[model samples]
Target: MRTLIVTEFISLDGVIDSPGGGSHPRAGWTFKDVPFVEEAYEIKGREQLEAGAMLIGRVSYDEFAPVWPSMDDFAEYNEMPKYVVSSTLSNPEWHNTHVLRSLDDVAKLKQGDGAPILVHGSATLAQGLAAAGLVDRYHLLVFPILLGDGKRLFGSGDPHTRLDLVECEAYSNGVIKQVFDVVR
Candidate 1:
């Protein structure tokens, strides 16, 4: 079976809502005004190229589509196969992008052939995938900030799922990168 990795740039408090100044209320909580280190960018660049396909939620898609397409830094992501999990959005203007209407569609995509499906910045979809027991791995990039009120990576309406830590690393800037495999 292919691996489905969910990658995230979250805060110390597990807030993954808007690490990139997204419209979400939790926006700018991660590194808010601070600039990222060169190592962080390098790591992200590597992850972007490593994934066979990328999956994202509607909110994330909206926030990213407009920018990534124009970003010279994320050329890999712009060219990769992208799957957007959206319920209401009918038309997506991104290249190599497809819309998944339901959880069933997501499962079907996961079953198909390709490189591992890497999910990024889609908390709602992540919750659903986690609850449905579809995720195979998680790559969490934990930043060094804390936000008391923000959308969490997991909790609230999500089902209980245990994760086994497969690997972990800590950067000098206090960025903790943890890779977890689903315990199913």
Candidate 2:
């Protein structure tokens, strides 16, 4: 079975919205408060190297499609197969992109063979995957600052899910990398 990994740059208060610049008031918080530490982002490089495919929600696709393709830093992701979950998205212009309609489809994809499907910014999709128990693992870079109001990585009323810590590291810049496997 292919592993489904959800990765995010999250604030200490659990906010996962707009770590990169967007319309959110606290948008670009990741870059604003945290000093750039090349070593702190090593997990991102590792994720790109390990991921065989990318799975994301429509919103994230909309946010990333126009930018990621041209970014040299995301070349691996640009070339890899990407699956976007959305009923409304009929056509995807991103290279090697496919549309999956529902979480049921996501579950089916998880049954296929591959290195792993890495999920980037897809808060709603991640929540659904967690609630449905489709997510296999999580790679979180927890930033030290707190953004009191914003969409969070985990939502309320979700089914109880257990996680086992696989790895963790604290950086000098106060960013922490944590890898957790969803315990089944």
Candidate 3:
């Protein structure tokens, strides 16, 4: 079975909302805002690029479509085959993208012979996957700052999840990269 990985850049307080300063309520709470990147900070992103397919939530797709396709920094993100999990959106404007109508479809797609499926910026989707026991590994890049109020990775009334830490590292610029395997 292909591993499903959820990768996120979160604040110390577990806020994953608007790390890129979009129109969202909590905006610009990222290392990009302060403009700092240690050499060690670059590895996880490159590693995620190795995944064969990317599964993203609709909101993340909308936020990323304009900049990622046009930019050169995230070449892997632009080039990778992307499967978007969305209910309302009929058609995707981005190239090399497919829309998944339901969460059940994720399991069917995972049965294929392919590299790991990586998920990014899909808070709601991630929660659903966690509930469904679909996610295999979780890679969290914890930033230095903390936002008291914002979209959290674990919302209210979420079930307690048990995760076994695979590995963890601290970057010079205070970014922490933690890898965990969801325990059954």
Give per-residue CA lDDT, model 3, range 1-184, as digits (tens).
7889888888888888888766656687775544477654565567556788889889889888888898777777778788999888877888789999888999988888888899888789988888777888988888888688877787776678899999889877788889899888
Q: Which candidate, 1 or 2, would have the higher lDDT against the true structure?
A: 2
Candidate 3 overall Cα lDDT vs. reference?
Answer: 0.82
Candidate 1 regions off by >4 Å?
Answer: 24-26, 33-35
Candidate 1 lDDT over 1-184, as tens digits, reads 5578888888888888778777667577556544566676555777777878889988888889889999988888889889898878877899999988998998888888877888988788888889888899988888887777777888787777788998788877778888899897
Error (Å) of candidate 3 at residue 98 is 0.2
Tell me, by lDDT, which candidate is best. Answer: 2
Clashing residue pairs, candidate 3? none
Q: Tell me which residue pairs clash in candidate 1.
A: none
Mark the regions of model 2 whose C-alpha exceeds 4 Å error after superposition.
none
TM-score of 3: 0.91
lDDT (Cα atoms) of all candidates against the true structure = 0.82, 0.94, 0.82
Error of 2 at 32 (Å): 1.0
Q: Compute each candidate's TM-score over C-alphas.
A: 0.91, 0.98, 0.91
lDDT of 3 at 60: 88
Clashes of 1: 0
Q: Regarding TM-score, does 2 or 3 come out ahead?
A: 2
